[model samples]
Target: MNRYDHKGVSHYEFLERLHRWLNPRTYLEIGTLKGGTLRLASCPTICIDPEFQLDVSSAANREVTLFYQKTSDRFFQDHSPSALLNGPVDLGFLDGLHEAETLLRDFANLEKHCRSNSVIAIHDCIPMDVGQTTRINNGGLWTGDVWKVVPILKEYRPDISIFVFDAHPTGLVCCTNLDHGNTILDGMYGEIWRTWRSTELSDYGFSRLIEEANIISTSRVETPEEMRRYFWL
Candidate 1:
């Protein structure tokens, strides 16, 4: 099995820099877990998680922070993101369910609440090894099959722009140029799931994915100005 050598900055550090560069008016995050990334947001923030292990008091940078202690699906079903934040999401980080189909659904739902320029970041899209790409998490450092979403988006939602960063541990996928009105992904969810649910990294060409992803180094955009230019912020 092939291994990905990611010597760039950690995802957390990259996200911190991203927050400063984007200076988003509103931020949304799924799978808050320990709130490591949630604390990075200094704007009006909405966090959804089935169970949160972090202390909310630590996110002192934000004046307005809303917490929904539930699954992303449940949160979306019960509330509109724009209504909750009083505007479309400026930046969103999706680190919820590790399954590709779940991530796809999360993307479809979240995009409807975003503007054309809004940025959405997906976690764990670049698995280091095939062992960590299994649908079920067997042990440490499991990314599940979330990497499949990269190709799925490339094939299905070609209108959007996707960029993969070589952040440590796994990788981060940032997507922009969104069309909230687009329903192609939602309409084709079943077919997409059927095609990708059983597929593995080896079968899909892991090396090809790494090569074609054109993963960018975090070191190149260490400063906010560099990030602004790279992402056209």
Candidate 2:
């Protein structure tokens, strides 16, 4: 449940919602380092990573269909944005090469797969960390240019909602609310609490987002029972 257990919101929170929203039959992961996050998603997965260093015979082995390759090239042909996604992907987690060009390329490929309501979750987007610094090494090829995709997205797809999870050293960017076909920017905070505190969340991932919103509200730990109140059982 804790992606790295650094004591932020549990990463499993969103998958709980996916269980209710789409009940996704297939899941895909771009990076499979030890399969920590991939396994928790609890669905059959197609994963790619060039140097993941995961043991093929370990407990995490059976849950995944591993692909050994550079994720970006395998996902797209001709390196064009239009060739980015392969399609019908219900859940896509981007944790591959962190270069801006690679991320931009990944985003393009993802467009083909994401449904109107599909969730496109990007990891390591929490301000600055190992993921953000790598691109700067390449003369800011990825770090500088990847965020440029944000404005491009807002321009081309004005309907999608963007929410950033408030976990430092590594965070998540959640692109949601494009499914219901509504064109309003009504910020829907997932009230993921069972007792319905005006401040608490009824679900997990969304609750994590809420908790992030109130880092100064309180430093209380959220229990699993409290998490179940807002999400799938």
Candidate 3:
């Protein structure tokens, strides 16, 4: 069985460290089911989820916190991230859907409201095994086909920089050097969906992804300064 051994800090720990170091002015999170990661943000936060099991007290630290209980697509259609946040999102986390097409749409929508320097973190882009990368969640540790987003971005949005960190569990893909005005992804969304929708990890070559991804160890950027310089923050 093909397996990925991620020997680094957990994704949650990494996010906590990132929040403390980056200290973004405004934060946006998709798929905040229980508000574990939502609690990390001290800045004004916008959370979108179809259904949330968040605690009322989890958002007490933020001066402003907006919760939208709807699918990401619906939320984007009804509201604008920048307008709601009162400015471009400084740091956005995409963890809404496990499907590649859905994540791609989420990324495209979020990118339009982010500045060039904004950082967007994509969860579950690295699956531990082929089983974890399936379209349906058979059982435990299901990352789904979200791993497809890494290669999709590399091939389509070459201008953006993607850093895949070996955070515990699945992995964390941090995208930087965003262009809010870039319409490349938006224009080709249909084509991209058609191209990648039916492609499985095995057919795409899991080994190829592992090699091309150049997954980094979180230990290398244990400190905030190192993390900042590594991602060019």
- Report the candidate with higher lDDT, 1 versus 3: 3
**Model 2 over residues 169-221: C-alpha lDDT tens digits?**
34456565444333222122122111122221113233343344222111121
Q: How much lDDT does each candidate structure score?
A: 0.89, 0.47, 0.90
Name the regions of candidate 1 deviating beyond 4 angstroms.
56-59
- Per-candidate TM equals 0.96, 0.56, 0.97
* Candidate with the greatest TM-score versus the true structure: 3
lDDT of 1 by residue, 1-233 (tens): 39997778889988888888888889999999888899889999999989899965645867889989999999999999999889999899999999888899899999999998898998899988888987778999999989989999999999999989999989888999999999999899999988887888999888998988889998888777778765643
Q: How do all the candidates rank in terms of TM-score, highest first?
A: 3, 1, 2
**Ranking of predictions according to lDDT:** 3, 1, 2
Ranking 2 against 3 by TM-score, winner? 3
lDDT at residue 86 of model 2 (Cα atoms): 37
Clash count, predicted structure 1: 0
Per-residue lDDT of model 3, residues 3-71, tens digit only? 887887999998887788888999999999989899889999999999999775765778999999999
Worst 10 residues of 2 by lDDT: 186-195
